[model samples]
Target: MSSNLPKNFPGRPASAPTPSEVPAPAPSAALPKNFTPEMARAAAALQAGAATAAGQAPSSGAAAAEQPAAQARGQAAMPGGPEVTRGEIADHFAQRIVRMVDAHRGDSSRPRLYAIEFPFTDFEFDVAYALAGRLGATLSASDAAVDDDEPARPLVMLDRVLNNPQQFERIVRHINHGQDVQLVCTRAWQLPQSVADLVDATLTIPRFDAPRFAAACVDFYELGAPPALGADADWVPNVVPRDFLLNSQVARSDIVSAVRQSVERRLRRYATDDALDLADLAGMDEAHDWARALIDEVALARSGAISWDDVGGRVILLGARGVGKTTLARAIARAAHLRYVEASASDWAPPQNEPQLGWMRMNAAFQEAMAAAPALFFVDDVDAFSIAPWAGMLPAFLEQLKGLSADDRVVLIAGAQSAEHVRFELHRRGALETTLTMPAPNSQALAKMYSVLLRGSGSTLAQADLEHIGLLSLGMTGHEVELIVRRALRRARKDGGRDVSKEDLAQAIIEQRVGPESQDRRRLMAADELRNTAYHEAGHAILELMRTRGARLRYASIIPRENGSLGFVLPGVDESRNSVTRNDIVEMVRVALAGRAAEEVFSGPEGTTSGCSNDLQQATAYLRYLMTRSGFHGLLSLDRSFEDSPELRERAESMLQAEYAHVLGLLQRHRPLLDSVAKLLIERQEVSGDELTRVVDAYRSSHPLV
Candidate 1:
């Protein structure tokens, strides 16, 4: 027995009744504000039960409540005189509750407000159910109604504060109304300061010992033998459910097999044989290394070499959607032999106009994760939850995370779009410390991914061919790569179920990464329309060659595209330069409008076609970016629609006009070179790479930038 009691508690009187002498209160008798005769009797009953379990006499302390001799210890005797066991946990916790009640009996003004932190809900339930029965208390949620005249009993608040802190305010109201209540909770971190002050103290139920747990199971289930556990076992009494032990087909002699069957049934959805191992994942080497360290720590914990608290697996996964964040998280869980539980940001979202529901759902998730320890708790789109510090329910979310992080058996993995968008405090120590970004896999990594997906599919490709296909699908995500492979497989099926060839894969890539092939549409165009398309593309190509030093013209096509382009100029961007300067943006805007400029320069303003509509829109976008994001208009850049501000809109339009005129004049000055490129494009449907580069180089050699 221990006491962290306040100084004002009075000493126990010598005349107080012993364990067997306390009397039950009358139905009409007014109950004391804090201490009730029923509670004292209940405490005595628990003490007597504990003493009997230990084969000793009950101490001369609180008096027992009236009950059958067999039921006093939560047991029941059959008609033939055989006694049913009530389990060790009930007896063990009974003694602890007796000491707690005795240590605090002198306090007469406040309720018996105590918090009990347990590892999982089953343990919490076992302790709570037994404690409530012994104390004659009602087991209720925070919202359950309380009768004022009932005997004082511990009001067990299971995961209430963490699930919804506002529920505590209701509790405060109950206490303020002078109700005889005792508060017991699983968490105190989310309790409001007012309620926290009223709480007497908190205690933790230690992890159950294997022998005690097995003994309880054997006695409860009447099994032929006890289930075996490792030397460093962390098993709980309810890991194998009562119903399972009673009804399962596994032989009673093989208790271990029954336990395994029950666990697998419970976790059938999470741990599957087909789930990829951490080693099988590709294109995420950094995440692979991170998971390797975590897996090793999990192994160490299982081996009893280290505690789960020492495992550093709490991390936030940052990446674009469809970049395999969820897949990678699942793979890690599989690798670590953890139960997988997933909740997205939307899962925690409150109903529209019902803000209180937010924390309610958030707490529910944390509660579920806690109940499933040695599990992976993954929350996708965490940015929506922790977008900013002042966001509603973010504090409660953090509090729940803090409580979860303190638990050694569960690993927290949060998925988000970007690390910067999430609150920095969320990434601080004791929270989700590691931030792993799953960027789009590069060409080489994509090549490996392709090879993996194509294996056993009867699709064979040379290494060079795979790399070439990977290069062609450069900007696609891993999901996109998989989609293309599936499409390729389908394509092969249409062609008599033949093995997927390089041409099939390439076509699939072109369909997804590029727009639909438009060769038939291009063939339908008039020669005059083809010539006009050539001139428009030539306009963009020549200006790009002249205006930007880093921009390389990959190709220019006079063929119509499925995306409504009559012809287009594709430029290869500089991979090394991550950001563009203001000057670079200016040149980009000019190149975007050059197609329209070339039309007027060659065929006069009246002859310019609506084919320039796309060009005008592209140029307008660039000009808006300069005004709103690049601070071209002012020192304070506002990332908003230019239409929101009249002045900003007018400024953008003026910049677009100025750039258009500038490119028009430049095109006019280089009329002869533009004519040469247009003529070449008119002869061949496309001009690209070294061929296009040489034509521009020859012109630049003779006519250099001033």
Candidate 2:
């Protein structure tokens, strides 16, 4: 056991308690009349430390020479000088702690065990007597060097003890047995895992941040507010006089601003240019609508117009890649005037070489973000890191989101390419209740978006023209739409000037879908082979233009290109309304076999080239969906495991062959229309959906359907 007396307290001997009229330390700067406990401790510590330094100056050796200058700056000439004075403040602190601790435990004779895990620099082990006094115990109130001993009764000191587990384990064991001692520690993570349940509760004292720093400085210095801090971590005032932080005069607003600046500097944050307005987000109706609500709600809550429980919370936006989900999230945060931070997926699931380091960095980022609450965290592609191979680290991430979601200030918006594919338990109702799938832009929305994108670039294209472009861009993303305008401008620039023609934009959409001709090998096909490719592609165009069945064909080109294709066709379909059936499958099979059928009609069996390879694969995939996935053909097997059985392959092959025969007959009957389309393709090399539909519509008006 150690003495609880304030003995050896500089100028005072080891003795019983006495109300020493010790002159309080005069602050270097002006302070307010009223003071918190923290302020009082700081003043007394600085005063006693200064007195001790002045008295010992002659014997202080090298420090003796610096005494005059040190006094001018309000500092002790010797090391750990302020700590000597802090022992004096411990007398008052001890009494207050005992009162609070006893109030919690009632009048019971059993001593209640507790720990004060303060930072190594701010640990006040000397004040253990105040806590131990309720149990008629005593502890030594002394400080000058770091201690790691788990002292009996009142005092048990540890200096960065979490870094030394052996000593920590011993202390934890003692406490877990319901011992009477009150121990002090520094970090919660440092606690022994074996005694986790024994801990009654834990309270976190956050690091010096903007709001608290401002309040502390304002009251401590008797000033209106604190000075603005810069992004530099070392920008704070020197407040080491017994852990009483501020002694300077600055304003509250400046302090908050400085803290905001520091948060951006110390944490992973997005730049200002990344902020988008909610009105600017295009084609993500579900996400966009929800964002408007979030912005409004966040505003109401920030202004105290709404209850705390009504504030925005967790949101998961499930959609395809490049669909503006991340952008939408940023826009909402910007509108709500909240700081935006991104959780890096790559960092979360790091390389196998140093995975532990990666998690540590990720956790640090999360902690820093939490430290600056009332901010928005944008986590893109969460499913990438929150899954099986790396699931061990996922719970920690989820726990963070759960914690933030419950807070009235923080807002979390997470995005994933495929939500159902995400195996994390966050998808459950309680974890992330507001999960929404982003709806792709329809023709109407696409028209509006195109007009908005082109308006800045000086486009006089009418509403009808915008609608036509939208129809062509049926399944394209917003990013792809921007690319269309850029590609159009570049193409127009090559043709004299940047006054882009409608055809140039149309061609841009074509190249965006099919591989650009520049990417193809320079090896040109023979004349006959070129014509064969044209006929194969034109067959697809005729069905798309004249047949009035299946998906609409948006672009067709016979030019050899990258991706191993001599020609490719872009088809348009509304994925949102797609409900595939057996008939749709049969019609698509005929369309898939159309190219081969056209090739056979033009030059017989030998002319039927390998150009139909893609078509066959497409048709077979659809067949599998029909048989196994959709159960369209009465395959009652509810088991979703992929089927590669010989019987299944045979059935698919038989169905494809039947469809191929029917397609051949249809192309033979409509060979002239196919030839006309093929001739046009061989000449122009590419045809837009609108032009194809226009010419075919004229032909159809003259000749009625059979």
Q: Count the backbone clashes (under 3 Å) in each candidate.
A: 2, 12
List, residue by residue over 1-706, the lDDT tens digit for candidate 2: 0144233233333332333312122222233323332343333444455567688422322222122211322343123211123322333344444445566677765544455443322334444322332333323222223244453333333333333445445445445444444445434444445433444544343345445555544443334446555565332322222444212242434444443444445433444355656786667767767778888888887777875357655777888886777777777777887767777555566556544445555555665444445567777777775565456656656655554433425677778887766655776654566778887777877787777777667777888878878888888887788898899888877877767767777778777887567554456778888888888887777765444445566787777766667887777775455686677777776677888888898989987887688888888777777787687767685443225477777777788888888778777876767788888888888787667777666666876422
> lDDT for every model?
0.65, 0.58
Best by lDDT: 1
Worst 10 residues of 2 by lDDT: 61-70
Question: What is the TM-score of candidate 1?
Answer: 0.66
TM-score of each: 0.66, 0.67
Instruction: Please give the distance, in angstroms, between residue 655's alpha carbon in candidate 2 and its true position after superposition.
Output: 3.4
lDDT of 1: 0.65
Query: Per-residue lDDT for 622 in model 1?
Result: 85
